[model samples]
Target chain A: MSGFDVGGRLKQLRMQRDLSQRELAKRAGVTNSTISLIEQNSVSPSVSSLKKILDALPVTISEFFAGEEVSREQVFYRASELTEIGDGVLSWRLIGARRPNRRMSILHERYPPGADTGEDMLEHDGEEGGVIISGTIELTVNGEVQLLTAGDAYYFDSRLPHRFRNVSDSECIIVSANNPPSFSDGGDAQHHA
Target chain B: MSGFDVGGRLKQLRMQRDLSQRELAKRAGVTNSTISLIEQNSVSPSVSSLKKILDALPVTISEFFAGEEVSREQVFYRASELTEIGDGVLSWRLIGARRPNRRMSILHERYPPGADTGEDMLEHDGEEGGVIISGTIELTVNGEVQLLTAGDAYYFDSRLPHRFRNVSDSECIIVSANNPPSFSDGGDAQHHA
Candidate 1:
């Protein structure tokens, strides 16, 4: 999905140039039926055949093959398909779990009532941020407690001890992301309280 | 906003350990009035004062001030507040524009009918990925054409010549992210045509 179907692309370019199959054949000095076979993908053209074909269209080989060998990386995810991370009282559904070499981790997080991370002693020392989409959460970072509701957000360096608690009865949802992906290997200095 | 309110945290910590003001002052060999003054933020506690106070609670100075100097970065964004980027036929709403040292850029893109980037020859050689949210887009990358509709997605190296055309009459919307942010500086190789 990243690059073109060579035969189909050739046909499209020829059409854009207003050249008929026979006209292109004559222009490329190839057999008239050669165009037919190539456009239909019935035959894979050789390199020289590609060169001659592209040359007749006045297109560069590099331009034609710029990303031909590259395959499409999956880029879409359904809510049901998001990979669930961590089995704590909260839920963290990670976006693009299959993406190769992602520089960040975006998650749809849900904090239910009675969810108190402070008691568990989970301190992830990475930069973390998020937008609270619904409900309220009491976020404590380095012992500073702030009650943030919907539309409120705070970002901070994570070297400090941090924890979250949903004092409300409703579930709190937040779209959060972390740099360097802190949840994958448990944590740097992991200890359960 | 990143660190604790010294007065509040002290009070909370004291309460957590079941120590009254007189009890803590007796434990730290300090005057009981000093605890009350500090707890009320009536005076900023000196370093030695903090050490004595923390000692009474059996908490380390490092643990208390781990990220105290670090200021909280803006962590939450409202949908109505996303910065608008680009003045093309498409609308790109950038998320977290105020975030310092951002590693990635997330955008909500909308392509109106007649919007086309091919005729403009706008090619950026960066990795780009997006999910189509609504309508449809005729995406041609290195001569490969794919019509992506809602729920479909694609990720590709932008080294290939790529152009987007909203072939459908309705507007198309997509949620996309890019690394290193390509739209700035009018692209790597700037040519109008």
Candidate 2:
């Protein structure tokens, strides 16, 4: 994923979870400045650091690495240039480099074995569509738990409370899209309505 | 752009244009069966044919080629793979192939001499944001016309009628995005409120 794009995604995710920067920092076991810098793309988090944050968000690192895009023409991106977001077990990558203002942000997410969004469910506005690329995910939405395997797709209103966990021993990979980019750097919190 | 995501995009664009398989085939001067096959992903449009159809839509061929995800680490696309969408008069590519579910879709549009939307201004829902990658674009939103050159940016409500035309002799590329993935495959039309 584009680093520039990650700022928006991070903001979106944070908002979806109704997390203030300070709140997220406190829960993720990180400093407010660390989250702020990471969200601003000023500092790229180490895999371990990212994992801790995802652990706090309850998102897995493996699920964070998967992202996607479709271009009119073929373009090339190098591995060294992958846009990394979140913590280790819940790291993510934006698929394209030069994408500017894309309507939707796709993400490749890696959920480590036993890692999850924790006991808390997350709810937000807009719509969410996702497909499990690999492994197994135990999804609880609106008080119902659904176990999804590879190739399974689920779409729901983001406003509904939800949580994801990996019950399998192996890791899980999921390809997902949010109607609005959700991740953001901790900036302009007071400015948000 | 990620090829894996193209299936949804093709469906979305066809819907947004409000052109059916038969209608699109008629507009592109192709057989209806061919359109059906392509939409189904049963057949890939050749360079020339794809270009002709996209030109009718006024989208550049580069978009078709540029939006594909190749691997887990980085995006790798080649120039040779660019699908020609415009008639050498305008070119465009979609960014954020990995993050198709983003709030807006970003497009890299190149306008050649005398290229324009060739229709009345368009008014739609959502917000439009763009940056001029190079050259110039004569943009008319409602009754207001603005000349945008490289490094210039624009943001506007899409509900205002808008159109873009290249008044310069050289090609102009624009990086643009709109929220809510406004383009659709006409599936929504079938629903009755």
Candidate 3:
């Protein structure tokens, strides 16, 4: 879904919690206009801003996304149905698009040779685990680097700074699942070059 | 994994947290013997007892199970490779068995007609979500009941009292994922008839 839709979901959650826009904005340390703008789809809230708003609601990011667009009934998404969430050399296929009430996001991710996850490391709440399905990838969690090949898996708290890159000459594929969902753009990974 | 295996995992977690057995018992409100017996595989803990012990550790059941047998490097489990954790009419196939350090438990669950989750409701920690892959099932959360058919999905906090049954005549299949992991035998679903 687009950022515009995220606004409506935020509004729904705010109302469900019986908090007015002004009250929520105050609790979230954001301005009432910011909340209003987000709800009206006039502006897209940044990931940090959205995190603050969700924290004030006492809801996880995954729950917030799960509460959006409850009308969908499609299940068992085929490979073609996976939503493409990444840009650059990283290709991320997110299972179940517009799935309501999602607690975890299952991703089929692919990284081509020489792919790097930019310079800025990723830090988020919740937990993440993945299994390398093919080829090899270099996973760095809080500066602890591990070169994981096919069949190698990892589980870690997402709050730790982490990055992934394809160190091998061949392509790498991984199936990963994470909770609380990530609010950043799928391709937040910057190219090392 | 069996109850004996759970004991080893519990011990590992306790050590990892650097908590003495006596201290853990005190925190869980159970006797030291209970903790000792559980850790030694001399006694199998009930679901409730296990919850208390896990809560004392501040770890979810999912995390506990995920911690067990961390040495394996197998990934991409085939249908036959799925671990069978269920008994009776409710069959559950767990993905990525023996894969180290998992954060989530994904289950391919099937329930034959007339199968019910017993008289006692199931309550645990974490969050759960599932999609009805085929047939129909009745899901009760708290006290609200919903009959979900193919393509329908549900997500809720696992602490809430909930139960499931195959209310339809045909068999039902669901692809479910839960966090903090469930510790009971997959088929703890008691049949009413």
Candidate 4:
């Protein structure tokens, strides 16, 4: 919520996408000066204004706050360090932020009581798989949707669009992995473990 | 080194490759009964014999011992749980194991002085990148070899038949991840992490 923190994250996100100030300003319908000022920490963006810019960038709000609460073991990441993304119903935590020289990015996702990714199926260009640690999640790939409970696993080609939802009232936790490890928020990743 | 552990891992690796006892035995230049006995814990093969079988499978010894340690956290994996892979020279450990439902796998790898993955290069079907944590490693992709030191990173397609080696006597450590998380040692799931 601090302008400095927001600006820092904003700058990181923008740099990651290889965006220039003028280009981002044009896309977000803001003045170049405004974008520059916000990035320089000279001005704080209102929640709505920030949301607008993020929407234009198409970055999820939850992803904006995903890198906090580092672990103490200096080896293992603490749960508190996990940044929660998405709504309270369906959220994801990026694990091991303090880890330097990381090769793959890891995420811990939680599906709320009766929450789901979406009704539409999704597909992408990566290898996806994971183990269900708890609760229940209904996943549909292609024309078939399978109800996976604890201990079950699914590995699939990510190019196919899929949908996921929590069938149980309690929260569902799933451990998932995608190959090629794109660690940003975009439509390229599928939500199933 | 125990007979029980080796027998179990052999069976798991076989299943991962979808090979039956008879098929594996034939390819391994051993009798079917011998393979069956080894898997059932009836007999332990000598080191040479086991190595022969492993070579036929084209897997490394490091993969077999990768998951030997157990984690102390409820769902969190301890850094101690990681196992060193590749002779005494090059080693790797898993970090994305805490919650298996995420889309990426994280690994910590180390290389010894003058240790190399050998001259043969490897190219995979997934995208890969990692930061160098310590020491230095000479990474060769296709015909290009880049000497990378701490904090440097490179991402490339796995199909390049790349090889990495450490030219120094001091050990080098790197955190790397591959799409789909292929077990270079095979699928022992050693629980080392």
Mind giving the per-residue lDDT tens digits that candidate 1 earns over A86-164?
5678777766656544434666677998777756445543455665667999887776678888755555665557788
DockQ of each: 0.08, 0.03, 0.03, 0.02
Residues B24-131 of candidate 1 have per-residue lDDT tens digits of 999887888988987776766644566577777755443343223444565445566767765777777666666544444566677899778756445653455565
**Could you give the candidate ranking by TM-score, starting with the highest?**
1, 3, 4, 2
- Using Cα atoms with residue i matched to residue i, what is each candidate's TM-score against the true structure? 0.44, 0.33, 0.40, 0.34
Could you give me the TM-score of model 3 versus the true structure?
0.40
Model 2 Cα lDDT, one tens digit per residue, A79-102: 334456646666655434234433
**Better candidate by lDDT, 3 or 4:** 3
Question: Which parts of model 2 are misplaced by more than 4 Å?
Answer: A1-76, A96-102, A185-193, B1-193
Task: Judging by DockQ against the true structure, name the best candidate.
Answer: 1
Ten-residue stretch with the least lDDT total in model 3 chain A: A184-193
Evaluation by lDDT, superior candidate among 1 and 2: 1
Query: Each candidate's lDDT (Cα)?
Result: 0.63, 0.55, 0.65, 0.57
Residue A81 Cα positional deviation in candidate 4, in Å, after optimal superposition: 0.9
lDDT of 3 at A166: 88
Report the Cα RMSD per candidate: 23.0, 25.9, 18.7, 26.5
Weakest lDDT window of 10 consecutive positions for candidate 1 chain A = A184-193
> Which pairs of residues have clashing backbones in candidate 3?
A62-A180, A66-A101, B62-B180, B62-B181, B118-B190
User: What lDDT score is found at residue A83 in candidate 3?
Assistant: 72
Error of 2 at A155 (Å): 1.4
Query: Model 4, A1-193: lDDT tens per residue?
Result: 2312667778888888889988988888877787787777776664345555776777744346433332122222334545455565677665443343223444556788788767666654444554455788887766666887764555554555667788888888765555434344443232432
Q: Which lDDT tens digits does candidate 4 get at residues B16-80?
A: 67788888888878778877877776765643455456656644333343333332212223345
